[model samples]
Target: MWKLSVACAVLCSVSSVAHSQSNVLLYGIIDEGVQFNSNAGGNRQYYLASGELNGSRWGVRGSEDLGSGLKALFVLENGFDVNTGKLGQGGLEFGRRAYVGLSSGLGTVTLGRQYDSVVDFVGLLEAGDQWAGYLGAHPADNDNFNNTNRVNNAVKYTSRSLGGFTFGGMYSLGGIAGDTTRNQIWSFGAGYANGPLVLGAAYLNVRNPNVSFYGSGGTVAPTTGGVPGSNFGSSPVISGYASARTLQVIGAGAAYTFGASTFGALYSNTRFKGLGDASSGPVSARGISGSATLNNVEVNFKYQFTPALLVGAEYVYTKGSGPDGVGDVSYHQGALGIDYFLSKRTDIYAVAAFQKASGTDSSGKPAVASLSQITPSSTDRQTALRLAIRHKF
Candidate 1:
């Protein structure tokens, strides 16, 4: 591990120098887990996993005071596989997040790869982003409530909190020459946080979503049935809708906290318009030539039995409809989890989840249960259990 030591030494040296000139902080999380899947390709499977509850990562952030009510700041975060020590988010250094921005009394503005407005406003309300983690992600992360997508070449703005209310917008420039409209994405969102109550809403639009959002995220598939842009293919939830000219999402979420208990509800709708690419585009199992849409609703509850212990349960329902007389598909899911904190910076957790599918899928075949972050099950039902530990600094 000499190489690792050398790397650490170099980082420490740089951090020390940077800290001398500005406010800088280094932080990270190490999360690892073991999981058991009742059905994976119709067979029981168990294995070691990473980022089951939270993606392991390290990051450095710094800010320099510029003037009255102004500051210059930047953040570089990297995701990695705790089990194999390999880079996450497709191997890019600082793949999880990298951005530089300025903050003022009015708000904050940043440029570079960053989250879209939808994620900032509504995603935080999901339990997956909290105690549930990736295993609790909605089917195929269909609505991106679990943060499966990120905007590249983006300029984002978030207004300062005004009486516990905030609003923001983000736009991603396609940067494709001679095609000003190609690969562009834009979104708007707003949120409110007041004692015991929290609410959020947003809408996002993407053109050539496969290339603008999916392809840019480091998911690779040199070729998938000759489709040029779409890289998502593990399940019909997205593959069935790929090749669409545009993708649109609208969602709202709300939560209420009283004492040591919290309750939340969320709704989202995703639509893919103008499906069916020329022979050069994504091919559908049933040769779908029209549009498709997916809708999701989730409700969850959590209670803190003690300052160090918490329990939660959630249920989700998803429905999909395809054009050209394609049969519809639906998924029902439930999850339960418990987390106990040994200390503020360390915690251990366990989660169990089950899902069932019905109707015809995008593949033009009977639908099979497909949980987010896992391969599709060979049968119509699947169950999973995981135990993990996380340490933060």
Candidate 2:
């Protein structure tokens, strides 16, 4: 009896220790809002919206100890529309993120669908992520500062911070049966933080932006005139060039902190090349083999008025050029935001933005202003307002 008792005690102790070495957690966030648009589809509109500030999402994350300063980690996150209770990301079960990886003192390597280095690094310093969210994104978010898409079949590596400096790189395989480069994407980014100053830079290149990064719609023959079902959706800014063969973006940002306030600025250059084939019969009435480019510069500031109240403002200037002989376009945007925290896990916020457009547009017509996907104004100016609440667990 005594020997049996001792064995049982030892077994229980081992079991408890093993259990403590692994952990799983479930978390979620809900964001709902009301938006008033100066014009929507050519009419003034007011609508209930989801994810005006941040996308609603639920996720499961887990980690298991592997001993010797190594561990295995995984995350599966899903996005949804709270108003309609429908899945986001084209109905993907875990469209936001799905990945498994190993982490150690050396660094971490992950595989599966994930964000690229650009979104991971420079995005954090932009007002689109730090404060105003989607409404503050550069026109069309052409530089991807808004995380408009995630890379599929990606392999990523992040280096452990060393003296306030860290870096990361990512690559997504096209996975085409015969062509390895059909939809390949690669990016790298680095950041440095010292005291109250932060800086970041990133570069991304996508071969066949429409078919590779956007989706598979552009796979149709070039004779189709344009890709179908592209991710560009209703945005008139860059949608017409969704059939571009390649897209490249470069981004850089910096921020400084002083007391309870922080100020930041960002710059990005996005280029779309190979719009169409010269012999493809005008390719939707535009010159073939044309290319487009957009340059954006933004400045923003945030202040913590109190422990529970915050304020932010931003201004952005954008210049975009259509294909050769297609003309040029420019935009100026201004935004203001405020947030009040009810608790550590919940908050209410409001954002207001105004934008104006000038010069010729992609269709060789005068550019009509728009904010992200709100709605293209019949004139050259647009305004939007949103009030939202967000809760996290």
Candidate 3:
């Protein structure tokens, strides 16, 4: 009896230890590049840039196993600018991501600053360093495929894969003292993956988007009628719509892989509804009233010639329309990329892009070519080239 009792106690102790466990990991990615822009502020420019293909970031992730098929997880990620050695995402300590949540057979529920459903389900299909490198973002990244914005004061729920399908949603409280609707944000999405095929769709809505989304970074110059002076940089793509009372975006994408190649396509509709709210930037000067909308379509291809070498190409078309007499605008852009992996965590790449624009812009002026990080072109055409190196750990 004594021997049996000791064995039982030993087994119980072992099971207890096995049932409770925890782990923490640190990881990061660094991408730096030299870029040449055909025109920025109307001048040819060459410079070193950081986070071209992937924003530089470091993060901590931890998880604890609970007794009952459940786990508690947390992630704190920080974004930084390799070139300036400064914080990215407007100096927020953990701008990239900061969330804690629980996971179970059902799914996950997390709270804190977080990426939206669109980023989780659709962004991967839009462009992956197969590669847009930041500069390749479709016409101002109007659809937010670039993850230019993150939700705050948010509660998110993500479901476990059922069959080949997964889905998630998020709601961010505006924190406005008296109003529950103003500045609120909500998003949802669904995705499917099976074999070589992957597909996704998502939608995002924000009230008083100018203050919540754009101003989410920090202080901003009030509407002077053009675009607001914010970290999004100055671009006519958002100029006239800076005062939008609400911003809505819906996007969908699909990708299929065959042999050594993959083909993908994406579509997004972005609208700035109820414009002229007098918040972010130059509002009256842009003459924007009512609503302004943008529709973008992109097709991309990627091919792997060897285990170490990959190439990609993409073409995008964007059309913009608005109220008042603001002329309609359209943009045509194309990109090519080559990436050579030195190892699983390090690689070198080159990406080139060209853009052409036509018609009047939101500022009530002729549209000019604008690349993601480049200045608006003086003419209607712009081109850019970048050579970069990326390391992950």
Candidate 4:
């Protein structure tokens, strides 16, 4: 009887320990708004929009203590459109994020669909993320500052901070039976934060971005007959060259804070090689394949008018040049935004954005001004205004 009693006590103690070490949490954010586009498909348009400032999302995150400073962790996040009550990320259930990993004193390694290193690190320093949100992102989010897509079959690793510096990398398997490089994608990034300054840089390389990212799924889809995701919605920014043999990008940004104000700048170089026909899906171009390069520069500033109010402004310049005979394009974009916190978990905001374009697109067609995920203007200029409310829980 004594021995049985001791065993029971031991089991109970173990159970208690396990229970204390395991935790799970549910969290989410909702954002909805009204927006007016000065020119959408050539006519002024006004409509209710969801996620104008930030996408609506909910997620579950948890961790289990394993012992010796190691733990098991998992996150499942979903994005949705509250206005339509439909899932984002092309209808996938956990389209936002779904990953499991192990964490230790050294760092962490995770597996499953996930964001690339660029979006994880350098993206935070961009004005689009800090001030104007999507409205201020580089044309078409060409550098992915808005995180338009997530990688599937991805493996990611992150290192612990060293003197306020952190670094990470990610790779997504192509998953093709015979070819390992087909549709593969890889990226690396590092960031530093000290005092009131923050800096970050990242690089990304993709094989067949059209099929790998634009098409139905990160999972390989037939190069032909695949429908691109909604990310291509109506924006004509980079769609002309949707079918590229390769896409490479390098980006860097820095932010500094003074008193109640912050200032930031960002730069990126994006390149596309072996372009395909702009009319057909993401396949090789019909005739002589060409290449294009884009350089983007941005600067922004934000000030806290009060503990509950903030205001910001930003400007971006983009230039694109293709091999001889492909034509050149340039864009000038500017934005302003204001936010007021109603409570710790709720806020209201307003923003205005404008853009002008001069150049030719990859299809040899004249370039027209277009905002990220918004409709394109029939002319070379476009303007937009939005008012929104956000709640977090």
lDDT values for all models: 0.86, 0.84, 0.85, 0.84
Error of 3 at 42 (Å): 1.4
Which candidate number would show the highest lDDT if scored against the true structure? Answer: 1
The digit string of per-residue lDDT tens for model 4 on 130-218 reads: 65778888998888877887888899999999999999999999998998988899999999999999999999998877766665343
For model 4, give the 10-residue run with minimal summed lDDT.
223-232
Question: Could you give candidate 3's per-residue lDDT for residues 1-393 as a string of tens digits?
Answer: 999999999999988886568889999999999999998868999999899899999999999888588999999999999988999888889988999999999999999999888888998897643477777788877888888778888999999999899999999999989999988999999999999999999999998877777767534445444545433457877756766778899999999999999999999999988877765433557456888889999999999999999999999999998886573899999999999999999999999999999998877788999877567888999999999999999
Rank candidates, lDDT, best first.
1, 3, 2, 4
Higher TM-score: candidate 3 or 4?
A: 4
> Mind sharing the TM-score for model 1?
0.92
lDDT for 11 in candidate 3 is 100
Q: Which pairs in model 1 have colliding backbones?
A: none
- For each of the candidates, the C-alpha root-mean-square deviation to the true structure, in angstroms, is 6.3, 3.1, 4.0, 2.7
Stretches of candidate 1 exceeding 4 Å from the true structure? 1-21, 223-229, 325-327
TM-score of each: 0.92, 0.92, 0.92, 0.93
Q: Identify the superior model by lDDT, candidate 3 or candidate 4.
A: 3
- Cα lDDT over the full model 1: 0.86
Model 4 stretches with alpha carbons more than 4 Å out: 1-12, 216-233, 277-288
For candidate 3, what is the TM-score?
Answer: 0.92
